[model samples]
Target: MKTTNYDIIIIGGGMVGASLACALADSTLKIAVIEGREPPAEWPADSFDIRVSAITRASENLFRHLGAWEEMQRLRVQPYQAMEVWDATGPGHIHFEAAELGEPNLGHIIENRVITRALRQRLREHHNIDYRCPAHPKGLLPLIDRAQLQLDDGSRLQAPLMVGADGAHSWLRQQAGIAVAERHYGQTAVVTTVQTEKHHQDTAWQRFLPSGPLAFLPLPGGRSSIVWSTTAEQAEHLLALDAGEFMAELGEAFAHRLGAITALGPRGAFPLKGRHAKQYVKPQLALVGDAAHTIHPLAGQGVNLGLADVEALAAVVLDAHRARRPIGALKTLRRYERARRGDNLLMLDAMGAFKSLFSNDTPGLRELRNLGLDLADHAGPVKNLIVARAMGLDALPAASLATS
Candidate 1:
């Protein structure tokens, strides 16, 4: 079969994949991004996507570096100046303020569609990248020095390096014989947009219930995006409620913190699971973004972690090129894996710990966690560190020794 060759072909052109392409747009290498779906051309102001991300400042910096942040801002993004967290069943609670850190805002809450749209637009201007959207994968063939992808159109594409940014159920990773360890959290995240009786004051609020954590993220026009995690069955029940009933239950659940939820826009629920690939790379095949690791969304750091992966992978690839080494070689790919896996694993573990500690109502553990929260809140330096760590501001820790 005839094959079109390039230096790199990335599968899945979501935020992370597209960001990688943008990162290398000015480089000498030819790159191609094949996405299975096309992003929407416009996001109507009156409607909000249920799937939104709490974008860390680090991710904002990344997009700024790639020249995409300004374009995203033009579309509409809500920068939250503060965050409030409290346990619904206990006295554990704390608040984080960007003012304390001398920063304008803690982060922005943006629709996933907005991010993908901004990235797709940026991809159009990059001369080095070939954007192939609405494309489907047919098969894969791994060779000695390169990997090949069979497209649905019966055409094959070859690249010295093929990356899987295709997400949690990555076809490329499976085709490359990479294994993943997965743990289903048995919880579903129900998301929707709501209008409250009072203004949010540009603050993000999170309340921990026994079922899971629920976040009320600030948005424009005194609206908020609600991400309520709960048992799957309960999630289904919540989705089935009429708007008025849903708003009633929701307002009560949040203790009417923002006052009554007067209106609800739309609702969606997604299953929660944590997955870690057994390996991030092998030979000429590699993985990034959700293909490498997926975490619980309680902390709203999922995309931030994925973007960090993009940064590390891009740096590794460029450094390999500078050293005149094959970018897809095992040694070169391992460097990228080594630079990322530990930090990702640490975060995954932390999220799991949070879920375990907060999801239980055991008297002893409850007291322990509440005490810890109170201590962390009162301890200025420690609270700052925790906030910094969640913001992806802390230095990336060393990757595990044996894993990659």
Candidate 2:
């Protein structure tokens, strides 16, 4: 059996793990990324991913700090200048503009593959980091001073700290005995990209329907991506639709705002749920990204939240290392948990409230919620506050999310 050693081991070399590797690249510590799948290669110029994210300014800063943003810019990203949100039942609507906030753009709509490829490219350039593909941790053996990892390929490695960035079903988190609070939303999101007859003008649109929220995020080249969340049966039926019929249904749902919608790509559905680890750390192990928590996609904040987690955890670990403290010390890990828990719980709760509020068929409740939106739209101070919060600008954010 092969034996290796490292100062730290990060499981799941996805976006967050790769970003962490780049952040720690300059450190003297030895790092290893244990990945179950091969890292993504550079995307072809014309390729598009169905999955996309709204990247906030803070998330962009973290990617820049890790040297991945430059690569992403070289690839493809669409900057959205405005956002329009409306409720289906009433004339309640709200609009946010980047210009109003004295910024060039609110956020960017970026393809998931582009970001993943860029991060992987950055990771490849770091000599201090070891990229182990098609690797899985067989088990974790805790020691007084360090922890031992037994890999599926009959390899042994030891590290003072192990990070689980392994998505919602994190093996490391489970192995470390971390409990998670989970709730099923009884909904599913159908995602796809569509070509529109008219240009989107770099604006994103969202509508709250009786079933769920449907969002059309503008993409470059006169195209847009859709995230339509609905009840399980509806989602299944939509997914089962043929390309032409599906686009017809989508056009009706979106009210054909971008003119005639045509040419639907492959459609995929993901069950909607909220999950948060009861604790973020245990002894020598720490969880980040989806491993730590997952919120509803209604606000388009899922990846942004995970990126925030990455940024905060990275700063805490780096600061501890600079101070010559144990990187895996429980006291140090507590700082990370403290910084993220409240914000994560808030997002989860807010999404839950929105889901329940919109899903109700009661006329009175619908009127009240729509009226609330109308009121917020006319209230300058309240509108500014909400927009700032959505852009990740107003709150006293974690160090990683702080803009310069």
Candidate 3:
């Protein structure tokens, strides 16, 4: 038996990859993170990135466990106490509140860069984890017991375990011959910041329309981060609209929910593509985060799901370490795959169903979904169940419970 310079080599150093590195910081494992891009810089108070995520309680706990939560808080975070959801075509509306669950808050709206920056900052003090930036794989070689990675810089590294935390178009997943199921929703999400005439009241607002769903995520200073999912054609046109016209159309789409839209900020659009790798592990290689699965952003659960992947993978690896098993063996990695694959698939299917149900303008579906929403609102148990699930405090349904 031989010990490599690194116990594990992880590719991708964004939020999820960085998270995995941070999670392993306290361990004795010698890990190296290979990333092609430069690390995120510290952000100023008033500056917010175009990308943000609704960090769930589960993810928050993971960040806390890794000691990155404090830096994130000190930099920026907006804790929303309530969530308001409704159908735009009709009167179907339901709400989730933190008080109902006896929790202090549902979650926080955090900038994506801020999180990566914090993770990178935390990695600075971790002597065991090496952060390699402006680097990528030129080649990968999987041996009988270990893997060799050749970087673009003509450098070589070997490890007993390798992880692909690289996002949607994962190079490592492809190299491992993993299959993926990808579905394009035929919609693009247009994201931007806006000012409402009325205060956000620390609540997240969303309205499902025939085109897609529109979310008004509360930010600081009465501003809200809006994610409008709509057809590609409409998304192009919407992005073309000047600030004034765009603001007008936004208010109309939202029906002036928080009064009129007073101002608009930078806007960008991304095609909504749902993806899931057929297998999370192959021999000494494993996949995590977006590399394994990507969900609809309507619920702002994409990043949350990725962070959860980090947490689960980290736990499985640590447990394997305690058992003195090769961390990347199929036997060791399958535990993580089994723990996460089902939950990830469930969320993907649920979001796809919601996309189909709410995007249809059929008279029957319109009435049926609206009625369902109202009924769900009045059903305390059902509503509580939903809130619990959204807060990530609910337990995963066991096979017995699910089958029954």
Clashing pairs in 1: none
**In model 2, which regions exceed 4 Å deviation?**
39-44, 395-404
Which 10-residue window in model 1 sums to the lowest lDDT? 395-404
List per-prediction Cα lDDT, in the order shown: 0.87, 0.86, 0.86
Model 2 per-residue lDDT tens digits across residues 1-404 = 76688988999888788887777777788999998886356545555789999988777877877778888898899999999999888887999998987899998999988888898888889899998888898988998868999999889999889999999999998898889999888899999988888888899999888999999999888889999999999999998888888989988888888878886468889998899999998878899889999989988788788877787777888888878999999999899899888998998999999889987879999899989998998899999888887877754334543331
lDDT of 2 at 70: 84
Candidate 3, lDDT over the whole model: 0.86
Which residue ranges in model 1 land beyond 4 Å of their true spot? 396-404
Candidate 2, clashing residue pairs?
Answer: none
All candidates: CA RMSD (Å):
3.3, 1.9, 3.9
What value of lDDT does candidate 2 attain over all alpha carbons? 0.86
Give the Cα-based TM-score of candidate 2 against the true structure: 0.96
In angstroms, what RMSD does candidate 1 have relative to the true structure?
3.3
Once superposed on the true structure, which residue ranges of model 3 sit more than 4 Å away at CA?
A: 1-4, 395-404
Return the lDDT, model 1, position 267. Answer: 89
- Of the two candidates 2 and 3, the one with more favorable lDDT, higher being better, is 3
Give the Å shift of residue 192 in candidate 3. Answer: 0.7
What TM-score against the true fold does each predicted structure earn? 0.96, 0.96, 0.95
